[model samples]
Target: MLAFAAGFIVRPFGSLVFGRLGDMSGRKHTFLITIVLMGLPTFIVGLLPSYATIGMAAPIALIALRLLQGLAVGGEYGGAVTYVAEYSTPSNRGFNTSWIQTTGTGGLLLSLFVILGVRTLTGEEQFASWGWRIPFLFSIALLGVSMWIRLKLKESPEFEKMKVQGTRSKSPLRDTFGNRRNAMTVLLSLLGCTAGLGVVAYTSQFYVQFFLLQTLKVDGRIANEVLAIALVLGLPFYVFFGWLSDRIGRKPVILTGCLLAAVTYFPIYKSIAHYANPQLEHAHTMAPVTVYAPPGECSLQFNPVGTASFTRSCDSAKAALARNAVPYSTVAQPPGTVASIHIGEQVISAVDGKGLSRSQFAAQTAAFDAQVAHALASSGYPATAVPADVNRPMLVLLITILIVYLTMVYSPAAAWLVELFPPQIRYTATSLPYNIGNGWFGGFLPATAFAMVAATGDIYYGLWYPVVVASCTFVIGLVFLPETRFAAAAKISSARASTN
Candidate 1:
């Protein structure tokens, strides 16, 4: 998760740098640079040596490259969306810009197909060792195609008009953030719209991947196949919602999606567990687990940098339970008392590793863990999800519903953002909040949710993170975000009238 978030941390910087360039230069040119920036690092990743070969330098280099990729992506969306919106008719803006939104799902679908193909051709052992690089190396081919398409692209009409009229902002960063009103709009956009959408997007897609593999113990192949099917089934809804936003309003569609996701996430995830791993769910209900620990002994278990040592007995017990995706409740005991896990009729004592040597601690920890595993197995917790028991069709359907919600909130977002900002500083204004929302709010979600789940010892407790974020977005967007559809059309009409 830390590695996954490395790119997100630098996305805003990419937005600012590339966004400023887009506002000053032409959108066509800025994106051309961004495409190369995005592609080269990806290609390099495929070829880069592992830690065994390059020592500590390998990970450091990977992090640096990931940061570059994030920056490129930050700049890419705003330029693409703003360009499309600038060229589109006011009546058709939502539908046109929605096509841009579809690219994400399309790209995901394509990558999944490629990965499956590579995995099949190379075999599991080879794929795990070196075949993974095939996907990353393939990015070079995509880069060439993108570069070709973008090179022939013309400057957006609005940008050309601003250039001819000398109406472009001399200082976009200052105009975007230094001005109080524009800055407030940026903040509202982040909180009320993009932040909510970002969380929903990650929860439905990336977090689901983690939950399936780590929590549900679903097979990697099955999980990927299910997700791919859901994405394919739900792809059309992007266009549907975008078109709907044109008729009704962006605010309504977006807010409705947020509301639906917030209200249904719990049930949807519960249904997923029921279908994906029925045995685990059954075990959870039948042999409910608890940890009895001393007061204030357990740590939060959020090791974002991956450096924290959870050596205390309470911490050890809770961490093991969380790693197994087992839901548990902690009962406070007296100070200095050791922690113990109660799984049905079995009682397993947790060992404190504070004073033991490394080898001694490892031996004790292994014995303790073995005992707990034995208890869990006796209580009917399966080591992995049974392929025969998985309700594949039902899982696909539930996951599709999640993607539909993602599409509803995301499809109209580009058009709405373009309409919100003036052409002079549109790229700069749009990219900042969008990247911040996705990069920070969405990117950090998995790590944050994992920590929450670990701390609480509730398998489903992590879900509250997205539900709360989406709900907040619903309320703030309802009150603050204007209907940009009407406002944008009116602006166009007024501009034409003056020209006439």
Candidate 2:
């Protein structure tokens, strides 16, 4: 998790560096550099030694590699978007750039298919042990193909015109951030546009997968297959929304998507739970669970990688329940009382492991957990999602709706963003806001949502994170972000023509 977060954290710096390079040099070459940077790290990860073979060094190297990939991605997206928009006619900008939008979901669908194929071929045990690397290793061939395609492409026509006219900015960073007007635009773009779009992107696609595999305990293969199908169904909507935006407007489509996502996320997620794991959903209501413990003994346990030592009895009880996706209420007991969980009529006490030796602690903890598991089972909690109870078609429909929302926000975004800035320092200006919104706001979503669920003991509480973000985006964007369908593009064209 930390390694993944590292990639997101350093993305802004990459945006700053590569964005400037793209502006000062040319969009085509800078993005080509970024592709190589991203591809090499991804390919190396497959060949890198595992933790068992290299100890701490393996993870450290992994984190470093992730950072490099993040940096490249930060630079890569802005350049690609700018390149596509610049090459396109103003009338076709939204439609053409929407093809670029498809890549995000399209890549996800492709990766899922590849892994599903590899897993089916290799079998579960081998796939878990070694076949996992095949997907990452396969990136090398993709990199080669991408490079070949990109190499044959010409420079952006708008950028070439700017160079011919000698209107390019000498210092893209200063021109972008040092000016008050441009800086304000950047701030508004983050708050009213990219931030909301970023959260929705992750919430719809990535978080659903997490919810299924981790919280609902759905079988990995089944979950992947269903999600892949939903993605395929949802794929064409990106172009549809982009085409729609061309006729209507970008602002309305984007803000509408945000509004819809904010309003519907909770119910959508609940429906997902009900369909994906009917047994768990039934147990949640039929057998209400609660925790009673001394005040301050329970912590909002966020031990990613399962390494944190939650020694208090209350903390242990809550963590155990959270791991099993059992929603429960909490009640404070007297100071000296031990922590206990109540599932219907059954009561199971937890031991405080703080003062015990390692061996004693493990034994006691195991015994306590077994008791809780048994109690939960008796109260109708299934260990895993029952295949017979899963409503696969409904799950696909709900997920497709989510991706549709994603498309509305993301489809016309490239053209919208391009029109937000002038050609002088467009790359630097566009990349910063986009990366911050996605890298900081969107990237932290899964971790933040998981922590919220763990703390509140409501499996659905985590959804509030995206809800709030999308709501803010809808409100801010409605009032602040300008409609950039035709006016801004015309303004930019005239600005370029004036220099000529």
What is each predicted model's overall lDDT from 0 to 1?
0.91, 0.89
- lDDT by residue for model 1 (1-500), tens: 45667788889999999999999988999999999999999999999999999999998999889989999999998999999999997688999999899998899899989999999999999999999999999889999998998888899988998899999888889999998988899899999999998999999988888999999999988999999999999999999999999999899999999999999999999999999999997898899999999959988887765666789999889888888888889899999999999999888889899889979888998888888888999999988999999999999999999999999999999988888888878999999999988888888888788889988988889899899999999999999989999888888799899999
Question: Among these predicted structures, which one has the highest lDDT?
Answer: 1
Q: Cα deviation in Å at residue 457, candidate 2?
A: 1.2
Per-prediction RMSD in angstroms? 1.5, 2.2
How many pairs of residues collide in model 1? 0
Q: Candidate 2: misplaced stretches above 4 Å?
A: 302-310, 335-337, 351-353, 356-367, 492-500
Clashing pairs in 2: none
Candidate 2 per-residue lDDT, tens place, 139-176, comes to 99999999999999999988998999999999999998
lDDT score for residue 445 of model 1:
86
Error of 2 at 369 (Å): 3.2
Top candidate by TM-score: 1
